[model samples]
Target: MITFAPGPSKVFDQVGQYLQDAFQTGILSANHRSAAFMNLYQETETLFKEKLHVPEDYKLLFTSSATENWEIIAQSIVESSSFHIYSGSFGKKWYTFAQHLNEATGSHKLGTEDALDVAGLEIDGKHDLIAITQNETSNATEVSQELLGALGEKYPDKMIAVDTTSSMGGIALDFSLADIWFASVQKCFGLPAGLGVLILSPKAIAKCESKGESGRYNSLSFMLENAKIYQTHYTPNVLGVYLLKRSMEDHPEIQVTDALVRKRMKELETVIAQSKKLTMLVQNSETRSKTVMGIAGEELFIKEFKKAAEQAGMQMGSGYGPLKPTSFRIANFPAITEQEFENLLKFLKEY
Candidate 1:
């Protein structure tokens, strides 16, 4: 079946060949400390910097998942307090996780209707770190890049950490706007859910150095020290890193993928606008997420729609969190072909 599940969704068509090649070449069992593994790590890091436009000065590290980055940040980066700003369930969960680690952690929940407004946001002076969810996967709302730029300017002293899990490879982000940017490979990277990619600015590294809290085995300092020599603090998913490198090589240039995603998102928007039975869950078009589209309708209609799509050989994502019964989600990732998207749109029209 053609899967539309948000994460662990669709992998690149070349994944089978890459995996086969890895098995035949013994890449799956290569020692993490071997020269071969170091080369592989450097190659992947180069691809991220050149193709994905990660800043040259920033350091890239890998983790088990993006969730782990939260703990790393709370323990190593936030010295005094952190202010979490969220618009959806995932963002709220991250905030709660930070609060558990630091008692001084606080949060600001933006109103759902005008969630993208960050111009008038007031952050406490005591909070040294500002956490922003770049893309709210649970609700399909995105914080604008322009808004992030504004925040960086307004609070230059406060370190900014952005969670770009669902939007990372699908969009071109301005790396200078935030101090720390992280994402999991499962969504836009077109890979399985095993590895997380983190890009940290020099400011973030300095914060970790000054704080010097070695909270976990995968602490920022340990990861940074190992990453300097193109290695990890512990054994990592070698297969996941290989797949990510292959996927990046397949694209070569991020603009090609970004343009395609924007084009397809527009097409999908047009189709959704023309449909009588479907409406967008995000009322404001400006704040709507291009990577994940959430559609809302009558409860029975949504149920029947998912059933129809499934019967037609499409496995779409169920709405996340509380919107499950009245809405459904569509992943607009690179692995999905133009023909597949057109076929899904045609099916939606017929339904």
Candidate 2:
């Protein structure tokens, strides 16, 4: 069945072939430190640059998931405290998780529909790292580029980390704006759930060295040392990297894909606007996420609608967190073809 679930959401149409190629090429059995694996890892990093427009100065590394990176950031990067700016569930979850590791973690909350006013929000001097979720998957909201820019401009000396879990590959990211950027491949890369990409600017790398904490298995310093030789700090997700490389090899560059995703987002807005039964969970049009769209309706209607969509051979994303009962999400990743979106829209139009 066609899937529009936000994550573990849609596999690329070529994934079956990719899996076969992996087996045929012995990618599953290759040693993480072997010459072959090193070659594979290096090639994947190269593809990330060519396809995603990641900056050359930024260092690339892999992790089990985005959640793991949170711990990595806490252990290796934050010495004093990390201040968080967020609105929805996932962002709050990150801030909460940071608190367990660092006692002085700070948070600034905003309303779900509120626009980001960066100049007005005061950040404490003690918080060394500033963290924000680039996309709020739970509510289908995104942090504005202008706000990110404002933060970078105002705090040029501070470290900035962004969780771009849902929007990384689907949009054109401004890598220069943040010191640390991370995302799981499931949402936008059309890969499975096991792999997450972490990128660190030279400034971020300097923080890891200055903090000088390398005890954790996922420490930034350890990950960096191995990455220099095109290796991972631990037993790697060999198959996942193989699949990601193949996916990136065939994918269009970010600018082309970004245009398409944004165009389709507008189409979805039009469809939702015409629908008597649906309203967007994110009311601010500018803040609506380009990769994931959350649409709301009556509780029973949402249940029936999802059931009907499933019967029509489409698997819709369930509502997340507090919005679960009244809303459902749609994944607008690159794997979802225009024709597939049209098919889903046809059903949305009819229902």
Candidate 3:
């Protein structure tokens, strides 16, 4: 099937070869502490930075999944408390998780259809970290980076943690706008879901240092110490790392891919706008996610829409969270080809 399930969405065409290369080259069996593994990790880190335009000074850390980083952040990065500003299920989940860890954790839910209005929100001053989900995958909305830039300026002392699980590598993210950024690879990286990438600014690193040793297995201090030598605090998914490196190498810089993604998103907007039976879940164009397009239809039509796509040899993404049964999603990631977009667009136009 032509998969587009938005996260484990669509594997890059070359991943099969990368997997084979991993086994043939013994990367699948390489020890995490071995020189081979270290070199592979270092090279992948370099490619990750170069491809995504992540600052050289910014540190790239790895975790099991974006979910794991939530704990890592709460445990290691937030010394006092975290204030969450969000609009979707994933963002709320992060807030709930933080609150579970630190009772003082706070939240402000923005309108699902509005762009992030950081200037308007009354954020408490005592929170050490401000958590924001850059892309609300469940609702197909995004927090504009322009607003984030303004937030950073307003609270230079507060660490900004952004979860870009669905938009990372698919869009142009301003690394400097936030102190800590993280994403799981399955969505846009065109890979499996075993690994997550956490990009941290130097200020975040200092905060980790100030906390000293938390003695936790996934403490930023312990992870950073190992990461300095191109290693992990524990055994990692070697094949996943190798695949991410090879997949990223297959593409050009992020802007090139970002342009393609944006163009396709526009096409998606056009097709959905012209659809007699379908409408977008997000009304505001400014806040809609370019990578994940959630389409609303009658509940019956939603089921049939997915069924039709499946019969046509396409694996459409089902709706997430509460939107399920009435909405469906389309992933506009780089791994999906222009021809696939054309095919899907044709199907969409006809259906």
C-alpha lDDT (0 to 100) for residue 81 of candidate 3: 96
For each candidate in the order shown, give its overall lDDT on alpha carbons.
0.89, 0.91, 0.90
Per residue, candidate 1 scores C-alpha lDDT tens digits across 1-351 of: 899888878988888999998899888999999888899999998999999899889888999999999988998899889999888998999999999988899998875556545667788899999999989888888888998998899999999999999999999899999999999998999988899998999999989999888747878888898888998999999999999988888885778888998998888888889989899888787788889998899999999988988899999899987899999999999989888989988887777
Return the lDDT, model 2, position 32.
94
- TM for candidate 3 is 0.98
Off by over 4 Å in 1: none
lDDT of candidate 2 over 227-297, digit per residue (tens): 99998989999998999899988988999999999999999989999999999888887778889999999
Candidate 3 lDDT trough over 10 residues, lowest sum: 114-123
Predicted candidate 3 versus true structure: per-residue lDDT over 1-351, tens digit per residue: 898778778888898888888889988878899999999888988987899999889988889999999999999989999999998999999999999999999999988788777667777888989999989889899988988999999988899999999999999888989999999999999898899989999999999899885788898899999999999999998888889888888889999989999999999999999989999999999899999998999999889889989999999888887789899888998889878889999999898
The lDDT ranking, best first, is: 2, 3, 1
- Give each model a TM-score: 0.98, 0.98, 0.98
lDDT, model 3, position 96: 99
Badly placed stretches (over 4 Å) of model 3 are none
Model 2 pairs whose backbones collide: none
